[model samples]
Target: MSSSNKPHYEADPNKVDYDEGNNRWTFKPRGLSIIWGNDRRYWNLPDQSSFAVDRTLNYDMDYDQRSEALSGPHWKGDGSSISSDKACPATCRVPAKALNIIWGNDPRFWQWIKLSEVETRSVGFDEGARLLQVNWIEVTGKLPTTMFNVASTTKYEVYYVMKFQVDAFGWHSVPIKFKVRLNGQETAKNFVLESYKEKHDVWHEICGGEFTVSKNAAGVVEFGMFEVKSEWWKGSVVLAGWSEDDVSQSQQTREETSYSQPRHIEETSTEAKLGETKLKRVEKEAESKAPSGSTRESSRF
Candidate 1:
């Protein structure tokens, strides 16, 4: 916070924008790159091991913990709060298999746009309920599917949106989802799912922690994210990363792991069985009344 303490740091070339036509360059620093006056530098050097990322390792250098630690004792970044650009590392050496954040979908009327109340209709149940539901979903993925240029590409690109609704004379919680895909097969291998909620009206961007996918021996792969608990109550399902070289192993495994509806057993209820029997008798009586030659006419109706 000293006016005279000059901030000393190296100028990152990637942060500098070059205009060939204008022959001018614009430098965009990650926030005000002001170094602490205490001369001690704690910069970690990037090495070859850092670049050789296997399936297990992922470098998501977001300043969440660092910023939070700095919040109490020392208000870094002028206490303006941690931002994505300032929080995430300027350069990350991630695994080739690790998927990056890509696209998301939060439909207003996913299941039912309009909120409503309905009464229970079970035989022995009598109750009324009111709940919000999502019936439909739409998603788009293009920019996040683009290739990353080592020389010219920016360190991080943001592609998140917070969709929220208003009800009960107040604003409801916002929905957040991430656009994620594999690093190499960006376009052909990508999926979408819900993101974490940071606050009442804000959803935090999906971190690199949740992104997961794995390749098998047959060159086939499996990848997906966790189910999002949105308005529908039921979780979402998304799949990406398929190849033609395998013997249907990944697909079978995915099918085996997929969510299934619970089965409903017909309990032996005498009254219900009696009702069904009576209904069948009524149908049989109605059929008997119809003339034999009128079968075709009744069927058409």
Candidate 2:
């Protein structure tokens, strides 16, 4: 039978009956198949209660669709990329445009580094390597958590993957070391990238093991890369994950609305308290103005 036409049974947890012959549990609806035995078992039937989230940071200018051409070789000072001290002159040549030049000094070019407190520089381009030189780019900050929706008393796992490349841009033959930390904890041992080798443009992958996110708390993912001692490092970084209890987009909106309900209730409660206080004050005034206790009682009657 087609999945849509298949018979579905809603089993009562407390009333499930065990069948000795089949070594399975039978439910209310006849012909419902629910296997529970040494040979076969089914637990936690699908209810579409989970949510998945995958987010990636775009650093390469080639794929940017903005008419302003926001992505490309850019530079910045003081760790802020919003303003540029200088920008590469615009070119109409197809070959020059394809170069996708990016200066490490221009903050506008580096969109991936959200927070930095150190001075950094971007150097030459490797035509064969397709890599741009970057030095002393110390970055540390929390990844976006607005997309997370976790529930209390439930544990959720966050898996992350970051891909990039590092090299010592021919200036030195010494190896270059790169550090990456997630959620304030070191994810992997620091590794060295050999300088000026044939494989200097070698790619690297950082696989962050599943980290548990506490209930009702947004997952915090932080990326940190230390200064490259000799050569420039270039590549893209990507982070993505999903939760066991996935929240649909509409459900997330509802959750946000629910968060506002308490404040609304507080406002309504304040108005009610004010009304009560006014009523009490008016009652006191009326009592004082009444001719006497018996006269007030007679008027009321």
Candidate 3:
């Protein structure tokens, strides 16, 4: 037999598409990267670029289109969007002060203000244009000097700060201002508040805004009112923020990681709850006063 008549052999790996889905570009054997060509059109695709010409010619697809050809069965094509859960509703309460409400849900906790109907159009209400309305009371209670020691102690003032948070998937919130009233007297200036969050839970905090009661006022501090402006989507709810001078660094790191989760902030007490403290008379302070004429340093807890 002549040497030219003998069979021919190629020393290269062949490209095989076993799945027919355009994806699954596996070499003939599992680990082989160098694909050999036996008089085939092209050789050594190196990275994706080398295969670009062949992929375009064989499939008549552009680079982008060819790249996506095989992305179906095994992978949900690139750039796919993921849907998220709706935002949960938030509630605020003050354990010591109880406002006039239909029910006292918890006997141990005194809720001074409640703003559930912040939503517009609750059945037969007027128009849905009302920003969240606040219900406040001028209940008598001593300030937690130990817990919030950063606040002024010389002559305590009733500053009303407002903070709020909203739940929205893709919607951006607009800035808004609200009203603060003390004993039926509304302030000329509105309190400004901002939003913040940890993990999935969001909160708003309004600080340094207070109403003052004169030493000659009848009782301790009276119920002063504070309102906030907020935009709500069909799926989101707003919550309150804390009055902390410095936010924890650990909280910021958690936001970037996918493992972030919600955390609860508990009220701390240095001493046991005093039985006599419940009825203790509130001394009238002379110097402290809020822009609003009413007396009482209030916040959304």
> Evaluated with lDDT, which candidate comes out highest?
2
Report clash pairs, candidate 1: 102-179, 102-180, 103-179, 110-134, 110-135, 110-136, 111-134, 111-135, 111-136
What's the lDDT for residue 73 in model 3? 15
TM-score of 1: 0.20
lDDT of each: 0.25, 0.28, 0.25
lDDT (Cα, tens digit) per residue for candidate 3, span 1-301: 1122323323233344444676545443212332332211222222323432223223565544443453211111111111121111111122221221111121111122343454211111111111122222111222222222222222222322222324322122222222334455543322212123232332222232234333334322232222212212211223221112222232463364332232211111111122112212111221132223433323431
Root mean square deviation (Cα) for candidate 1: 26.8
Q: Write the per-residue lDDT of candidate 1 for residues 1-301, one digit (tens) a residue.
A: 2233444545445445566876765543321243552222322122213421111211232344333232222101111221233222222212111222111211211221211122111111121111123221223222121222223322232222222222211112222222334453331112222122112222112221122223221121122222122222322221111111111232353244322211111222343345345434544554576445332111100
> How close to the true structure is residue 296 of candidate 2, measured as C-alpha lDDT?
18
Expressed as tens digits, the lDDT of each residue in 158-276 for candidate 2 is 21212233433332322222223335554422222222133332222222122334444554544333333322343333111111122123235325431111111123444435534
How much is 37 displaced in model 2, in angstroms? Answer: 76
TM-score of every prediction relative to native: 0.20, 0.26, 0.23
Candidate 3's displacement at residue 247, Å, is 20
Query: Model 3 Cα displacement at 275 (Å)?
Result: 44
In angstroms, the error of model 2 at 98 is 22
**Candidate structures ordered by TM-score, highest first:** 2, 3, 1
Clashes of each: 9, 14, 25
Q: Candidate 3: minimum summed lDDT over ten consecutive residues — where? A: 79-88
Instruction: Give the runs in model 3 whose Cα sits over 4 Å from its true position.
Output: 1-176, 188-204, 219-301
1 or 2, greater by TM-score = 2
